[model samples]
Target: MSDVLVIGAGPAGLHAASRALDAGAEVTVLDAHDLVGGQFWRHLPDDRAAADEAQLHHGWKSFQQLRVRLEEHPRCRVLTGTEVWAIEPEEHGAAARVHALSGPSGALRREEVLLTPERLVLATGAHDRVLPFPGWDLPGVFSAGAAQALAKAERVAVGERVLVAGAGPFLLATAASLIATGATVVGVHEAAGPSALCRGWLSRPWELASSARKLTELAAYVTGHLRHRIPYVAGSAVIAAEGNGRVESVRVTRLDRDWRPVARTERDIAVDAVAVSHGFTPRLELAIAAGCAITADRFVAVDARQATTVPGVYAAGELTGIGGMALSAVEGAIAGLEAAGGVIPRQLLAERARQRAFAIRLERAHGIRPGWTDWLCDDTTICRCEDVPFGALSLTEGATQSLRAAKLSTRAGLGSCQGRTCGRTVEEILRQSPGLLGTTTTDQRPIAAPVRLGEFARE
Candidate 1:
């Protein structure tokens, strides 16, 4: 049994494993991908030159340093291409057991490994929060994160001409990356107004001033947008995507301060593909299954020491909230030290508080306004997995409703994705529907990811 088991190899997991090893704990790091760095510092193919790869990823040096240390440390082990399906906490005085299937890409008959660790740190990270719009189910419509992944990992562009739309600083980064990969970015439609940006800057002036590198990066991305002639339109959103089979054009709509579309402000922009994302939602399947307490805002709740309500279970990174890389690293270090029975320094605690405040402000500024549902038409597909349309979700008056009941009636969120893609949208619909007793939450399942029957039999 390992002393500590980190469930992800992202920034949070990497930092946690390193700190735990420093405290004389045996650590095992498992990840679904074949590389150490998560999406942020995705590893380039071996054919790419070291210098070229370094140039593409900003956190190359930090990732390299952590990777080297982890590799050299005798007490640490890193396992890639491993999918954890379930985590079962043991009874009193027994270590928790983690069930996973391990294999190379496209390989069958994966070996099953059961990991027993005294402590578990969850840093499963997050996924793109997609809002439904017409033609979103088109072939060429991809999430902004998916587009960036294609460009970074495979050096492939989503299309010759792309229109990126969303509300957040992430849109800027996505646009910059697409342009770097020889794609013609027609425009970027940001739903939030300029006041959001101004508020973020003014409120977090000290945070911005403290990070010189971040300021430089902001300048660089702004310069790229100017050079590429990509129009970064504020107070606008992609109201609809239009095409026969694939994305060919998008209808952009101007929005008011409350994010309601203004009349006669719709315009058509021709593009081969559309990459849209509102923000990120934490991947809380594993955390929820472990019985961790979540915050009112739906993030996993943790104390300053990064310890969850459950003993011997800690969470960091986006699992706790949608903090950026720096905050994730700090939280991971604190969790790692505490999990390994080490003292958290006072200075570290202060830094975590400061960074967390900035994260909260950022989240508030980019919070999705409820009025975005106006973009959805009665015929728009809300749950693409089950082919459920918006018109099918009609709720009866004065009837107590729940998401599960709606799923039973309309067959929504019952498909392969298991509600990861449309769960948030469905929840919102339920909230707005009249006669609902209260807000509905996602149903928990034993297995976080799908597993083949043969693999289960092997286990």
Candidate 2:
């Protein structure tokens, strides 16, 4: 049994494991991917040259240092290719047991492992939040993060001509990555107007000024945009995609201040593929199952020490909120120290406070407005996994009040992906509906990811 078991190997989990080990705790880190670095530092193929690898990922040096330290730490053990399916909290002072399948996801022979740890840190991270648009279910359409992952992990281009559409700084990053892969990026459409983004930065000049490193990182994206002469469409969205079994072109529309499509502003842009993402939503299933309190904004709520409402269960990174790497590191360090029975330093707390304030500004600037719902036609496939159309989701006035109610009525979130892809769309639809005003909650499940029946039998 380890003193601390961190579920995730991202920046937060890595830092948390290091901190706990520093405090003389036996630390074990588990990650689903075979690599220690999470999506941000997605590892390149081993055959790739070091120079090529360095060119692809930023913060490679920092990640290398962390990886080396963790690997050398005698008290620390990092397990890759381990998918934690369930966390069973024990009563009467028993340590929590983390149930996991140890092997590649689709492997024929996977070992079932139960880890009992005194404290658990969840750094499960966030996933791309996608809004449903017409033809989104077609091939060649993927989330911006998915495009980045493919380029980073597989060294594959999503398409010859790709149009990246989304909101937030991530869009620029994805565009830059796609351009690096020699893809012909037609344009990058952002739903938020430039003025809103400018105001978000202006509102917190101190935070902006402190983010010199972030600005420096963004310089490459700006350079790529200018060099490629890619159209950076502000206050714009891809209203619909058209293709024959695969995306061929997208209809871009000028969005108003509230992100509603403007009339007579639709323009067709030809592209082989479209990458779209609104923002990020925290992966809160494990936290919710651990009985952590959720904030009004729907992220897992944590205290000053990063401890969740549930005892012995702490959360960091995007699980708290999508505050990027720096904030996640700070929160993870604090959580690790506290979880290992060490006092958190005042400086770390102050840093966390500053980063959190900046995160609020970011969230306000990139938050998805409900007006995108206007783009959905009655026949648009909102739940692609279940083939549930927008028209099928008819709620009687005041009849459906919750996400579960809506899901049951339309069978929208019941597919194999299990609402990971379509839950947000369903929630947004219900929120925008005139009769439904109930709070949207994160969907909770017994298993975090798909598990084979044989694996369960082994357990």
Candidate 3:
């Protein structure tokens, strides 16, 4: 039996496994992808074998270095293209029982029983959160992250004319990348206005000099928009997308202080594609399945140790909460230290707390304002997966609410990309309604992708 089994090979899981191996524990790391680095740095074998190392995505370098270190450790085992379906307490005196599919099928499956290590760290990362509107289900519409992935990983463009929409730092980043890659950016839309900058400046003092450095990136990104002549439309959002088979045009509107759309202020812009996203939500499937306690907002809650309520289980990185890559690496290191039974220094934890406090303030400062969805007419689609309109889902006794209550509501979650694209819109809609906060959680599944029955039959 292995001494430690990390469920992900992302930064958090990699750090945890390294720490455990350093502490003389036998470790095995598993991931659903064929390579490490999770979403931030997804690479295929071709990417790994690329002749131009400098052309490799910056994010993958860290994962590549970690992969080399782990591979050289005789005590560690790395399993790629593996899915852990369930984790349960051991029946015998063993520490825990992990059930996983070795490949695509049940044929080569194994019940990995590990002598529950002193700790288990989960660094599953985060997923894009999108808000739905009219014609969102069209082919050319994708989350901003997906657009980046398509270009960076798959070397494919979703379309030639792309308009990036939504708020937060990611919107700017996506726009920059698309513009750099030869896409004709019609415009960039953000929900927040100049006031967001004022709030950011106020919290900059609290985070000290570090906050200033980060804000510089946002400023640079905005400046890039101006230099590119890509109109940065603030205090606005995409209200509707119109297209035949794919997105060809969209309605953008400026919102009032209360977030209501001004009448006759809507402007239409034609674009072959749209990359829209709000922000990210923590990816907590592994944590939740391992019985970790989730917070009020569905984020996996952990104390300073990065240990979850479940004994021997820990979470780090965006799984705990979304910050950037630096925060994730620091959180992972702290979790690793604690998991290895080592004491984390007070100064280190203090730094994390300080940065985290500032991060919370930043999130609130730029968070989706109240009544933002008032821009959506009753006819606008709320659940793009099922083509369920806002009014149909919002009515007091609507079938929408009924499906949600019965947990039979795939309308919001069952799209081509599953719930990754529209889960937040559903949550926001529900949160707007009274008494609906704790109704459900993201569906916990063993494997996130479809497993072919033939692969399951493989030995």
Every candidate's CA RMSD: 2.0, 1.9, 3.8
**lDDT scores in order:** 0.82, 0.84, 0.70
Candidate that beats the other on TM-score, 2 or 3, i.e. the better one: 2
Candidate 2 lDDT tens digits, 1-459? 339989999889988988888788888899989888888888675666346676777777888888899989989899999998887777655346778888877898888878878899999999999888999989999999999998877778899999999888889888888877879899999998878877766675876666566667778779868988998988999999998889889999999878999999999988999999899988888787777889987888998789888889899999998888888888989988888888788998887887787788777777787788889898999888889888777533333576777777777888888888888778767766666656656468769878878777776
Extract clashing residue pairs from model 1. Answer: none
Report the C-alpha lDDT of model 3 over 54-110, residue by residue, as the tens digit. Answer: 243444566677889898899888887777655665535433566556554444344
Q: How many residue pairs clash in model 2? A: 0
lDDT score, candidate 2: 0.84
Candidate 3 residue runs with Cα over 4 Å from true position: 44-61, 89-96, 104-118, 206-208, 211-227, 396-421, 434-438, 442-459
**Model 1 misplaced regions, further than 4 Å:** 47-50, 105-107, 395-400
Q: For model 1, what is the alpha-carbon lDDT of residue 74?
A: 89
lDDT of 1 at 264: 99
Sequence-dependent TM-score of model 3: 0.85
